[model samples]
Target: MSYQSDINPRHSTWRKVRHTLSIVSHEPANLLGALLLMLFSWIILAPVMSVLLNAVLVQSGDEGRTGATEGTFTAWYLLRTLTSRMSELLLWTPLLNTLAVALSTVAMALIVGVALAWLINRTDIAGRKWFATLLIVPFMLPSWTFALAWSTIFKNHAIGGQPGWLEAMGIQTPNWMAYGYFPIVTIMVLHYAPLVILIVGNALKRMDSQMEECARVLGASRGIIAFKIIIPLVRPALLSSALLIFADCIGEFALPYILGLPVHFDTLSTGLYRAISTRQSGVAAVIATVIMLMGMLTLMLDMKMLREAKRFVTLGGKGVMERRRTLGRWRTAAAALPLLFVLLGVVIPLLTLFLSTVMILPGRFTAENFTFDYWIGHNLDTVALHNGILLTPEFWHTVWNTLVIVGSASIACGVLGLLVGYAVMRCHFRWVAAFLRQLTFLPYLVPGIAFATAFLSLFAVARGPVPALYGTPLILILALIAEKMPYASRSGIAAMTQLGKEAEEAARIAGAGWFARIRRIVIPIQAAPLATGILLPFISGIKGVSLFVILATPATDVMTTWSLRLIDYNYQQAANAVVLMIALISWAGTVIIQKITGTGLADGLEK
Candidate 1:
């Protein structure tokens, strides 16, 4: 009897282990969720931690300055960056410049973006839909388009290059007009104003009209109603837009580098680039760390503002009427405003690019100066030229590189984003879901330049199983994927949130595994959004410059990097042609996304 009892105890324990294993093995969703969570932590968290570590650790051969051995912790970087004599030039000045440009850009964007949103959402403006659709075109194009256009028009002899159009017309463009804060702010406002319009416009559309009606009944003036009630209601959205615009501008490298480099006007992004270019790894790490800290602060502020916004929720289960204001005699004028913006932002820049491409001598508008050689002629003899752009092996190679790299990265982004969305939206464990969401979104909040720097520092050397990725195409692809995850994940989550659990649950009860359910039931229903999730990253990756410029090599030169090289070599015509091609591709992708999903790019972005 004693032997039987001992044997029974052991057998019972074995049965319990089997039962637990069976239960866990059946819950494939949980398994997949856990797997994805680990992968994200390793890929995203490791690089961030590396940047922070690099800021404090004494790198090899730095023992003399810190009096500490390599790999040892030191406060020398902090002391030198924050308190040393070069602090002003290194940290404070760039910081101030970033703030100034960001603030100025926000002020202008608010004026333009808010007014346009109000006109479209509230007022009976003429051609409202057409105007609204066209205004967002600038956002799809790169932030540097305006800067490049401005340079083409107003570039002076100060830089010793081909003179601008105005200069060729016997006009001496002033130094202030050609470059610096003014042009940088102008370009950023046009590029980012769409963000404000989208956010604030959504808020405006959902806003209850009862408060405004009551104010109207109280005999309040139009201005008074706008100042007292309307503005207050949308304040959270405006604040959110401002924060987004500031974050975008603060990390912007392309526009500032193009316009500010000639005059030594450096922002934080430019400073980081300069540090990296000069092989100052420690300084670059410190700068990247600072940028990340700033980003975290903005994120916290955004969270707080959003939390407070929840208190003022006017949309409810009740039927709320949104009354559009009559424009009376000003309808035409309101319509003209958007047309003007489009003219300045899109039409003019594209027209300038086309003109620059056809001109044998850039900025010379003479009939004799026009030639199709840059487009299709042989024996071009230009920088990095073989034949014309269409017939050249080099150009086609760049195009193929773009397709392969962007294609690979985008597919990865789409799958990961979808999985992340499913996990977060349907996760039973609340803390795990929250953690996953936050980690997935962290890459979005980090500046592109800073993120690139972190990846370079982390993967430059082989760490255990991960081989050194320096001077390789894989690093570029990895960086692109990380930076684009937020867009896809956000869209996926928005789509999944609207989906009910009934369909998925039915599949589960019918013995559907996690992968099977996702493929057959969940993804089929969300096909449009899934396609959009893939297409958004694909579009953005094709035109991405700031993230890949530092990591790109000659062998991995995509369209954007190739264009940058052409610019460096003063091949303006070829560069302009490349820019136009990029814009066309991006626009076509946006159109495809819109056609498939029945939602505009702005709608997907806002969601």
Candidate 2:
């Protein structure tokens, strides 16, 4: 009987389960990975599921409209969003506009970004290093900074506040040029072009000059060499950058709110914002669902394209020779193109915003008009604003809120990311490592606005052990941490992969525990990447608007939300001042991080 039981299938299965549990109990990293896998699966999937459920169910306030009991599933919201008469205004038009803007921005940004990158990395253009450094500055600023700057220069009399510089100079800028598709696309192109440059430049930097030289030796024309050899070789980066830009533009909120709202031109993001603002939770859920789907689709396509692009590898075991094509007589002229972009995209916008803040009136170039009232004056009655931004407790509160919330979220994300990396690399369970990795990366595929809506749906009311977080700062920090997890996880994973297990093994041999090994061996060695994991998310959170806009209440207002509030009150100078301050903070933070880490923004893009 004992021999039979030892050979029984049930006995064997029980033994296997016991063995696995015993192993997991002994290996702390594997145990941690298993726990993280469960926690992250819930953290990532719950909000998305909530959003989808809310789209189909009759939410509390939506019960009357849908004629269904609250929490019961109904298709009324979907029908109203997709097939009703208001669908044109609420969904289809915005959808079409979003696609159009995303595609156009991608195309224009590719052209400009590719040109600038080629000039700097491939051709011997003058000031290559300077242009490379300066161009990334636009990306450091908020995406809406360009929109605000454009408004400062081209805003017409449509909304009726302070006329823009062009209008004030008696130019009478057309509404199309001021606040609609054109400015929105142009600003997005300028803002995202630097991203394209980084991605494509990294590809170009790795490309061998021998390929181009061989093409030329075979009597290939310059255009054919570029189109056939260079472009195809860098197709992966192009596709990656294009999809990234498209995904980002489709879900951008602040730009459209600033530049497209007055003209009644709405993208999916802005339309979703309006729905949420009006308490149309059902409708907003549908819109958020669509945006999320679009973002996921873009991510899928990016992965597919990258997989296909793997067939064309530029680097191999051979010694690589990189030769820059000399522009010769045109070097100076070629240099001027990137210089012009930096001027138009970076310098002009920042200068215009600063000037607008200092001057009492728009476009007036008098010394008397240039008082520092917007920044430092006291008791100036400007529409809804009472004091200058510096003097206002509200502004300082917003700043403190931004630092505390973003800072806490970033630190948490950084530490969590390092743990995830440690688990992934050190865990004995391959499946747990894989699941945790993929789960952490899932947030990157969801649009910020859509993700915010998901959080709103999930946390608006109490769940099992969690309290309602609708009016609290904790919600913002939680959302920011989740939203920025991909960046931190990638940084941590990359850094950890480079480190060997030899030291940890030696420490273990010395009877140092797992925590001690990590504390003494891992943390000190990976400090720079740990700092990177913290600071990158911090900078991104500080400059962010879309993610926080939906989650922020008056009590939880951050810098971006505060600036939008000032805009709503028609306090142009104050709004611009707030925006300028946000920009300076973001820029300073980025500089400080770069100095600490000894890594440029472009450094990580190569991977």
In lDDT terms, which candidate is top? 2
lDDT of 1 by residue, 1-607 (tens): 3554456887899998898667547655455667878877776788888988988999766789889998889988777778899888878898998999999999999999998888888888998877777788889898777777888898888886677899988999788889988899988888888887788988898888887898899999989988988888899999999998888787889887888988888899999999888876777889999998888788679879999998767755568778888999999887988888889889999999888888877666679989888888888866467566777777888899999999898888887788788878876667777888888888877888898889888988899988999788899888887888888888778887888889878988998877788889888888887887889999989888877887888898999888877777777778778888888988898899889978774562231
Tell me the spans in candidate 1 whose CA falls farther than 4 Å from its real position.
1-23, 315-318, 381-383, 425-428, 498-514, 601-607
Model 2: how far residue 33 lies from native, Å? 1.4
- What is the Å distance of residue 387 in model 1 from its true position? 3.4
Measured with C-alpha atoms, the lDDT of residue 510 in candidate 2 is: 92
Estimate candidate 1's alpha-carbon lDDT, on a 0 to 1 scale: 0.84
TM-score of each: 0.92, 0.96
For all candidates in order, the CA lDDT equals 0.84, 0.90
lDDT of 2 at 355: 92
